[model samples]
Target: QPALCPKGHYCPNGTRFATQFGCPEGTLSNGVGLQDASECELCPLGHYCTGVGIHGAPRGPCSAGYYCLRGATTRTPNDNVTGGICPAGHYCPAGTSEPIDCPNGTFSAATGATDVAACQACVAGRACPTTGRTAPGAPCSAGFYSPLGSA
Candidate 1:
């Protein structure tokens, strides 16, 4: 006979409190006949959850190009994709899911740069050349003299 499995818990077989266990800290699920904790999926990045999930449904995902933390829910939900932005003078290449800084010779003033190509080279005359890491802030700020590799 089928056991009386409760919501927010899983019943692999004929069992009760002796076998049922709460969902792990990073996962959630619902329904009956659940076999293992693996049925509870980890909350995706850029999202959060407050209480245990009613069903095996994701709370949400962060917007494109923006990063969101884990386990976000109604109280801690994201209003926009402004969780964080790839700072200027850095790049977030499409190849990887993480953000990276631009090389010394190159710099970028744009936000959410999703590729190394967004990094702009410090120009001559208008701006000093960049060396590495320390990219020019607005083309050397006029008076600050910079050689070919100013970054």
Candidate 2:
């Protein structure tokens, strides 16, 4: 008696055929019939898929220090990971995985920096006056007024 083909395998007019069957869409055949279709798997945390088909081959993993920017499928050979770069004036301590902001008194003139130099002591006549203040506009402390007033 003729029977319906399996979900993934091929059937001719209600006749189930085991061999020469095509794999279901979005899946790849690793052998024959429904049992031959290989389930698609997600790329590893540090890796991404660039193309289709899974025949015992693993997708490439992102390089050390680099992170995946967007969600990608398929297996490809060009995927890579990049290290975190800090901005100017900012310091990303060694072994630190994420970017950190420069201290309160420090400033970053650029992006992806790693280290921040102590803010230049407020100019000779000018003083920071406060702990979190930087830049040349900071006012002088009490009893230590700037001779130039608002220079």
Candidate 3:
């Protein structure tokens, strides 16, 4: 009486006239059959999985100005590597890893800058009047003046 036993239940060998069978322990028997369970897999690069048994869920990637470390399981928001973004009042040159302060008289109009060229300099005939001054239209010193008022 093989039909007497439910699917996934184990039946002893040579029991053609079996009337009872026991389900295996430590295994799932959903009335289908015995099968192995799938294991969790690591997320691919640029993607992160936060939970177990994640079959198909959207993953987050490192945003601009940020980098993911090797074997990273979680990412910090707005976190950056040692050479990620240019420091305040500094510029990160093309293809370089660190930020550099703009020259004495130069000033960066924006933060997180990438190049020295973006730094605006005091126009000719106008003076910075002081060190680390950022405003471009700073009036000229006593000895200098913008005759043309060009900026």
Candidate 4:
């Protein structure tokens, strides 16, 4: 008889069945009956909604070195939680959603790096130019030499 609540599941208010409730993790609910649960939606930027209900789709992306951000429930983000990894100098390749600096010249103290050859160059005397440089820069001020990779 009473229909509705379908999209990702959600009923409430005298709800008889209809999946009772699902949309949880980062959120989704494409819309159907959705009674409460904030209506569900988030889980966008970078993606990672591992609620196992919404179905709206999103349990992907945010892998490589790591980045995510938005509602990322868990795709890699570590240290504590909520989009992390790929720090030092930045790199994040694969599904990387963000953090991709390390450009001008080249530098990377190392963290998650996934692309750009892990940014290295610029070392001879140190220069780096600047972009996300984790190191290499406070050494070419004597007579300005810079040779190795410079930048």
TM-score for each of the candidates? 0.42, 0.28, 0.34, 0.43
Query: Which one is best on TM-score?
Result: 4
Q: Residue 140: error of model 4 in Å?
A: 9.5
Best by lDDT: 4
Give lDDT tens digits, candidate 1, residues 41-134: 5555654444553456555554334444444343232344323555566554322223566777666767766666777766554443443243
For each candidate, what is the lDDT? 0.51, 0.38, 0.41, 0.79
lDDT of 2 by residue, 1-151 (tens): 5444343344344344543354432233233223333433333433444434433333454332233322233222123232334334444443333344444433335543334453333455564343323254455667676543223
Better of 2 and 4 by lDDT: 4
Model 4 ranges with Cα > 4 A deviation: 6-19, 33-42, 47-66, 69-71, 74-76, 79-82, 91-96, 106-124, 127-134, 137-144, 147-150
Q: 40-81, model 4: which lDDT tens digit per residue?
A: 787877768876466657878878888887677888867435
Of candidate 3, the 10-residue stretch with the lowest lDDT total is 32-41
Candidate 4: what lDDT? 0.79
Model 1: weakest 10-residue lDDT segment is: 74-83
Number of clashes recorded per candidate: 12, 18, 0, 0
Selected candidate, larger lDDT, 1 vs 3:
1
Which residue ranges in model 3 land beyond 4 Å of their true spot? Answer: 1-84, 94-98, 129-133, 146-151
Clashes of 2: 18
Per-residue lDDT for 94-149 in model 3, tens only?
A: 33333455665565556556566756676666644343335555566687666432
